[model samples]
Target: MPISSKIARQMEEASWIRKMFEEGVRLAGQVGAGNIHDFTLGNPDLEPPPEFVESLRDLVVRPRAGMHRYMPNAGYPEVREAVARWVREESGVEVGGKHVILAVGAGGGLNVVLKALLDPGDEVVVFAPYFPEYAFYIDNHGGVLRVVETDGQFRIDFDRLEAAIGPRTKAVFVNSPNNPTGVVYDAAVLARLGGLLRDRSRKLGRAIYLVSDDPYKKILFDGTQYSHVFRHYESSIAVYSHSKDLGLAGERIGHVAVHPAANSAEALVAGMTFAIRVLGFVNAPGLMQLAIRDVLRACIDPSVYQRRRDVLHGALTELGFECVKPRGAFYLFPRSLEPDDRKFAKVCLGKNILIVPGVGFGRSGHFRISLTSSDRAIEASLPAWREVARAYATV
Candidate 1:
């Protein structure tokens, strides 16, 4: 049987991050895993909090029947209610159980929201240097992805964004403490984006929604504050994950919170629930849903990530790589010394180090280094990085 054209096209454009990880594995096999410095994937090296594991064990071993069975297409009411309470407490918004939908993860939540809202050929606007998956998610539902360039530092360019929105624009995606750049959009910038969307919606006589992908909501450092988009834009939905925050990436648990004050909030939520069913998630894993209800407020300590960040940032800068000191998250986007970022990545690989080229994330002349490795890996990788920089310096 022949594969569909759409699936074939998507396969041709698979994530470079995954590609780098595969290459690293191959290199490791060829030249002993201990010798290669692989920082390609953002898989956290930290263990999940002991309390979380304990809670999971307690839930799984309990004598209650039907604990493993599917409950609702959205989720168990109690779990959704607990999550809604957390959102209300954090954002001071009036959210109820009806407004929350449990998803497999932030990735699943995003796809569900896109499938629920996007009609064929509808447009979704995203800032440049975004998480590459945003394009794939939009295209999965036959929506056109419109990428708007940001300022030199990757801050939102309001003028360019305003020009991109038109009658067909369905949603705008905002990821703070962003994946590639790690640049968090401040309050003032969010306020301007709110005004732009409001005015554009009025002019076009259609409501455009804001989709906030917030897996890194709690992974901040250096007193950085991430503005809640729902506070700035009324037509906002928060698709959040417990992966980065709780170190539960493999568990696949997250939610979509449709702002209570959003226009047609009820309809939007209903559509999302339906999408969750049709997309075959059915519901979030039963055990994880129960486990997160008790630990929604808990997160992996920022100090560990902070220490890793400090060491990596200092070493890279001293080696003559210009990197935007990340305010949050466990990744650093460093400008490549050479104009060809892919070539720069190749150079690093030649030194038994692996990183992702920034061209995959809509920017060239840069590369991403994940700071989620062990301290030993970071310590061992620096001299090799310096060596690569020196080689490029001569060229």
Candidate 2:
């Protein structure tokens, strides 16, 4: 049998990042690994904190009877309680175990939330230059994705966003320490967004939810503040992951925190639980849930990422590339030297350097560079970047 038309359409739209990675691998084999510089994916080369590994070891050897068994669909209550405590301390919001739903990861949490909220033909407002997967996730749940393009800096354009929210809009996806751009949304901007949503909700006589996709919440640098969206908006649901913060991307552990103060919080909680089951994640991994409870305070050293960010940002800037200084997250979105970002990416590939074209992230004339590589890789890639820059300068 043929694939469904919806899935077929998704498949036809290949990920530019993944495609670049494949090309990088092929080029690396041809030119030898020592010669090629690939920054195609944000897969961190850094190891997880020692505490995470230690927690995993302890969990493995423990005599706990239900270590591997599925707990409540919402997840192990103790884990949720621990996470809620952390949330309360961080966000100054009163939360409890009942407000949290453990999921496979941020990606899984997003899918679950979308399933819970989206009715056919419902509209989801997404800021452009977003993680491309968001479009796929919304479409998966029969929602229409309404993209709002930001200013050149990729900062929130309130006017454009305010105009996008209509009666059919069910949710808005906000990614801070955003992927592709790495620009953190300021608190004032978030407050404005909250006000806009509230006004629209009142006018429409219905609630419009804010879904914060915040895997990079804890990964900030240069003393940047990351806002807790729920504090700014009553109807916010946070989908967070330990992948970036704890350097446990492979662990696939994370949770969804539905704002306890949200309108219809109880109904939303029930819907999230049912969505978890229907999405086939019944519960987040049992062992990882217990492990995180023990090491809830553990996180990767921000300084390590900070140094890498500075090095990459400095290198690109030195080469005369224009880029928004990433306040957080380990990515640099440098404006392409030419109009055709795909062609510009091809030129970089010719120099044995791999960076994903920004067009993949719903923007053109820019490309994303992941700083999650080894320092050696960052240092080695400078010459190729210089060569690419020189070529552009001469054009």
Which has the greatest TM-score? Answer: 2
- Candidate 1 stretches with Cα past 4 Å from truth are none
TM-score of each: 0.97, 0.97
**CA lDDT of each candidate?**
0.88, 0.88
* Candidate 2 Cα outliers beyond 4 Å, as residue runs: none
What is candidate 1's lDDT per residue for 122-172, written digit by digit as tens?
A: 999999898988988998899999999987788888889988998899999
Question: CA RMSD for every model?
Answer: 1.5, 1.3
TM-score of 1: 0.97
Mark the 10 consecutive residues where model 1 has the least summed lDDT.
10-19
